[model samples]
Target: MANSKWSHTALLVIDMQNDFILDDGLMRVDGGKAIVPNVIKTVERARQHGILVIWCDGGIYGEIFWLKVVREHDPQGRDVELFRRHLYSQGKVGPTSKGSPGAELVDGLVIKESDYKLVKTRFSAFFATHLHSFLQTAGIHSLVIAGVQTPNCIRQTVFDAVALDYQPVTVIVDATAAATPDIHLANIFDMRNVGVATLTLQEWCEADA
Candidate 1:
């Protein structure tokens, strides 16, 4: 297939920040680290296929925490969600808070100069954000998603993408995770029922090769 086959597609890497995926992270997902390699591989494949890479990261993407990692908030936690505000309270550092250690993307998943980074403050990247507008302007109609914690951020984003009529909303199964295998698989089943194309990293990366 020609490289332009994916010209209208974008690979959305969501909430792979340190705090949500690392071993000692503030709110670690037990299955996060295991999926790191697959997620990294997915990005490399996307680039090889000339697909647009957009990093949808921040402190809020995963359960509204990872999506907001890319967006830093006031020191007093003024803009943080009600539940996570305490992480920034009393001089404590919150996970994925801008300028905080946990807010950074984990090693090996660097955002390249050619890639775009989006900051979201909710479970869905499209909610309260210009992601939809940007995608439309970029002429992107298909989205391939990868990230941590499937039930919250991944599912919500996928659903909104469907609602917005983004065709072929693909999710890399091995590239996304949750606290447990059962949770992850169950959510994947739900997403599949909604017409999502859930495939493994290898299946997606090698399909066009």
Candidate 2:
């Protein structure tokens, strides 16, 4: 597939890290495991369509992508959110700490060489990051998102995408999830209200644009 057709589109895969999606995660997203296959499927479809795949994760270290490893917390978790600081408290390295196994992408999802890796310290991938400049430089204006825990990472990212004027932001409904179906649906509802497009993986893959 010639990438020219999708040159302006990018698929942002967020927070597929082991700590957030796997059975042994430190703070797993309740329904994250079930969507792993769908996320993989979405990545394959994105590649076939020639869309730039951007892998995203939250951390204080290295640039990453499927997701990358952060360097490690300050042992005291000062870099982490106040509520989540407990995760790294008491000298614990905490989940998704740099070089930690939990920061790795869940099994079955991979980040290809051509994909871009981005690390953020907060929920929105664009927050205090070069994501906006990178997207602008890449000439990307449309986004397709797939990932874990819709209410937080996914929702905040989508909202930020809209705020930044990324037209036609789309979320592959089945490829991303939350703690429960009701929570997922409610968040999806709010996104729709703000003009985000919510579709299934199949729907997104088949669309001409």
Candidate 3:
């Protein structure tokens, strides 16, 4: 799959936020920092090859998704009802909530001002966000995905991209993290078996070879 077939590819970095990646945050993915170097390298290589690099950040506010999660686990939980009421009260379940600093792409990425930046409220960037339209406008047919939290955002994004007929080549080295290594590994395996094509960072760098 390497051999100039990826020339029109775009690298979509998803939700490498401070809250999810940095220490001392409300929700941190374990080993999230370890993948940063690989993600940076992938972005740099994509740029060197003149591939489109689009960064996606999830600026999930107040917490409708959080409420859903808690409700899933414990339907009668007070925390679930509290957060659900808060998020619903604020009307933040859609495009109205974006552009927050929490949704900002992480520093240390090699992004130009002209490079694409999209803000999404859902796990799948293609949903509700302008990401799909942006990709279509750019004539992008393939996607190289990276970022944090394999089971959630990364997983959903890859599935949606594939469903939308984009060739999603996922860099496992750069793309994912989980609450535990076991869970991360399981998610990666599931993805590899289904939606996206798995590639190592080195393999993707040699894509033109």
Candidate 4:
């Protein structure tokens, strides 16, 4: 595994911001801040390999996403509408809210001026953003993904990348977390057994470059 061999690889840091990780943020994933060290390790490795690094953050204006979730979950008899209402009133996911300090990238994730920063309107970064085109332009054939909320953004992005014929490797240490350990563990299992290739921080760095 050598850096020179992975010039075409890229690293996608998904949704590791204050809003998703901080306690006061609207939707905080437990242990989100704790994963910073691991994410930093991955970012360093990607940079060392000359791999393009892209930061993907979710954004919303108004109650578009929350309202949709409420409708879908209510159909299943889930009590999500109340929470959705609260989130909406609290201004959680509305219009440039992601630019707030709480939604900014964590302290040490390493976003250099030369790196690319993309704001996504949905869970999957490729859905409504220029992520795919950016990768193609950079000749990126493989991706190393790390971010918050494993069951949401990280999982969606990895799945979407696979659907687009890109090899995706999700680093467990840098990827997902939920409100509880059980939920996080379950998500990791589901993702690994599905399409995404899951690895630890150390394993990912030492893997075939």
- Candidate 3 CA-lDDT value: 0.59
**Candidates ranked by TM-score, best first?**
1, 2, 4, 3
What C-alpha lDDT do the candidate models reach, one value each? 0.77, 0.77, 0.59, 0.60
lDDT of 3 by residue, 1-209 (tens): 12245545777777776556676533567868778888778666665566666667311111100000000112122223244334434433311223334333456764454544465555677766677776676566787778877888788888888788886656555455777888887878888887577877887667557
Worst 10 residues of 3 by lDDT: 63-72
* lDDT tens digits, residue span 120-161, model 4: 656677876677786676566777777676777777777788
Candidate closer to the true structure by lDDT (higher is better), 1 or 2:
1
Q: In model 4, which regions exceed 4 Å deviation? A: 57-98, 173-175
How do all models score by TM-score?
A: 0.90, 0.89, 0.74, 0.76
Candidate RMSDs in order = 5.2, 4.2, 8.9, 8.6
Tens-place lDDT per residue, model 2, 92-202, is: 878778778888888897665544568766777777778888778767788888887799889998999999999889999999999999999999999999999999988
Candidate 3 RMSD to the correct structure: 8.9
The window of 10 residues in a row where model 1 has the poorest summed lDDT is: 58-67
Best by lDDT: 1
Clashing pairs in 4: 60-95, 61-95
Runs with alpha carbons beyond 4 Å of true place in candidate 1: 58-72
Could you tell me which 10 consecutive residues in candidate 4 have the lowest summed lDDT? 63-72
